[model samples]
Target: MMPETFLSWWQFNNARGKQPDMSNKCPPVLHVPAAGEQAQRLAALSQTFISAFTQQPQFFTRAPGRVNLIGEHVDYCGYAVFPMAVEQDILVAVAINTSGRLNICNVDANFPPYSCDINNYEINKERPVWHNYILSGVRGIQDEGGMQQPFIGINMAVTGNVPPSSGLSSSSALVCASALGMAHSHGLSLSQETLAEICARCERHVGTQGGGMDQAIAFLATKDTAKLIEFNPLQATSVTLPPGATFVVANCLAPMNKAANSYFNCRVMECRLATQVMAKKAGLPWRTFQKLGDLQRALDKTLLQMITLVEDSFEVRPYSKRQVCELLNTTPDELNQVSLSENTRHIQEFKLHDRALHVFSEAHRVWEFKKVCVEGGAYALHTLGRLMQESHKSTQLLYECSHPKLDTLVELSKGLALGARLTGAGWGGCMVALVEEDKVEQYKEHLWKSYYSKEAAAEGRPRNTLLFSSPPGPGACVFVK
Candidate 1:
């Protein structure tokens, strides 16, 4: 089918709009095949759904994974992040069921089938099951007070190309697809912005205190452009990348599950404590501030100014529980109750200096990265590459989130790409490299030979699955027959 003829039978006018447009102002609809490769992908997923459920699905919902190009770990700090939707995505085929229970299946046999009553459901936080991400989205909608009728049941078969625990946001994509499927199954209408915010809050049920960058980009992304995703209203502005540059996402073959461990939450707690301490030092209602970005705004200081303030206020040595309690003028119990997360309450030493310095400096790099992308010049690529390298360094030294494998990959990728940095929440995820379009082949070959080949020779495994290149793709959408 041609692009214009795709999803022509959906009749979107009755729901929201007639078609998807360049401005991305309309609700996400699959009127056109997302680029060339997704056409075959949609067809295969449709067939899989029919075979799995023994019924033709009414429609399909898609949510793409995102790669943070420059910004790292600052989204929860309330700073803007630069990210783009990857072509790899989660696609779900949905069919209405009268059984009053939601049935979910995955094409990958590793994840088993899951089913629960739509009206009565509970998310498991003690041990986060994979399907809880879907449940969280459904619960989010149920918590929203404006629904006219209760949500109906659905039979969903899902397929995804994005690798799990690789820092490409496979979980968030699943949550976004589930939210879209739940809303559509219930005959409910939600704007893209509303859905993004709801899904963002909903993922918190899985026990990660993340900002809205993943869901916002998953819903608001446009083709061929990275988005400058901002919070405190949740807006997305498209950013055209410099020409002849390609983003290559390389996996170190190491997986890090953020929900299962406290490494991710530890950084979050440190940032929160750092914010409150900085606010208390500045005498700006420290109790009201929770994020580093909020403190920056309250102090009316530039990003550089924030860095200076961090140096002046915080010591290089780690702060003990007693020291923090004294600084905040509270007891250890009170500090634990108010400042720390459930997983981080036992942490006695907090790296206030390093975490605060990373947040301020990294936030500054995001703005500079955007400026280079917006105002293209002869040295734009070089300048942008330097910023990315600096970001990786700060994430390594200051945030202390980089794994040994990630550091080795970054070191091996030098001279072949403009810059390489660990993306996502760090601690052994994927690293995104900015490579010239023409040099991507050489870059891949070099990485394969330098890193993957050595590992394969040592362990007797395949080398080809470790790396690939992707472009900015569309966000969440619905495909109707």
Candidate 2:
């Protein structure tokens, strides 16, 4: 096999410049289903190959995009969320050498080089913070004995076609790629469990604390299908996209300010408080309430009571709708004479309009959406669109994770991209879009004028915005793609 570096051999064969007859944009020699591309006519132009490229056959890995079908903000809140790996992702071509060196070059010109070595892989080093995601993965693997003793130096190059920070889990895609490369080169077979755990730790390298959704999706998903992944004890099940219509996604171009100290943490704290309040009322620890009916009843009662007291009950907060015991530490029995009508109003307001409702409903919506997607029923696209809108509404009105800029972008996208909503962690993160095929160009044009143009004028040429369509690709793969 001549060391089986897939690309090296493919390029060697392709060097004769033999033209591929078919119109498929993919190369004649490569049949990687994970690539999620299949236009037999090679898509990469001759310009792409002018510069020499190397693929170390010793290691190969792929990671996919994580799309939160529903339950966007509930992941970090200990709430069940539904997300799936889309067809798009990052593929890493890695090779090990005795050169005692680590170097990385991205296929796209957008990001810079990622180079580091065993000795210098310190905790939270600053110079190449951008590559920290991958570095962290490598370090985690090494920490867990996934690395070999001889310091298996690597010359790795990455090709990232995935849009950055559009909330598609690009960072996770890269982390998994690095982990696979490291594990393969070091002769380690990391079970999915270990891989997910390693990925969680590696993600912190990006300087953003994230749940394991991105990494898990990249590692576990299958082609042409979405996976409903659960974090606790780690479970994965497929959720199929409807056949006829493609769910389109657009980049709102607005970025999240997750780096801020209090923003992400405060939401986390709030969710914790909600769970604790529910647990206390139920006379159980915060962990139980596995059934939907049980969870719904508790949340509904808790919130409806708070909503009832909103108007006349000065003790109840219009926003949080907490009882005196919740806020002022008063006992529930002490308020036995409290106006039931007023208290009920407050609880209703909280249940319907408060963030608690969003968490519970969004959590529940995941199951609903999964069932609809799996059964292949005639679920209208409008209905799907409405669910997406509701998901965003919950994120915004209830959860308060959405940003003003994102809301504006969503408003702007309404006339163009069919459905537009926040994609990632909300609070100033990326938004998703569902554009019809022919309307894609029109949508992008409108988006450019509306977002990038103004941004460029204000800030001297903003980054490039990508628009792509990919079918569900293989979860993660080696030379088989």
Tell me the TM-score of each prediction against the true structure: 0.92, 0.69
Give per-residue CA lDDT, model 2, range 1-481, as digits (tens): 3435644554465445432222222111234443335222112311232232343243346677777667676665444556666766676666654446677666566767756675466646334344676777777777773444645567666666566656787777887878766765555656665677677766665455466776776777767777777766677777777665555555555554443234554454444445445554556544443332244455565434533422222322443434424643444443222312211322322322254566657766677667666666555455556677788887888777888877877788786555667777776546666666667667767766776666643255333334344556656555423
Clashes of each: 0, 33
Off by over 4 Å in 2: 1-57, 99-120, 125-128, 145-151, 205-207, 257-262, 284-355, 375-379, 415-418, 435-464
lDDT string for model 1 (1-481, tens) is 4322433333343246522332445345656365576777777777877887777787789999999998888999999999999988998888766667889888878888899898888888778788999888888778862466666568898888888898999999999998888777655667788889999899989998889899999999999999999999889989999998999998887788899988888998999999999888888777788999888888899999999999999889899989988888889888878888888898899999999899889989999999999999999998998999999999999999899999999998899889999999889879999999999999988888788877743256444335888889988988876
Instruction: Please report the candidate that would top lDDT against the real structure.
Output: 1
Best by TM-score: 1
Error of 1 at 352 (Å): 0.9
After superposition, candidate 1 runs with Cα above 4 Å error: 1-26, 31-37, 456-465
lDDT minimum window of 10 residues, candidate 1: 2-11
Q: Compute the lDDT for candidate 2.
A: 0.58
* Residue 174 lDDT in candidate 1: 94
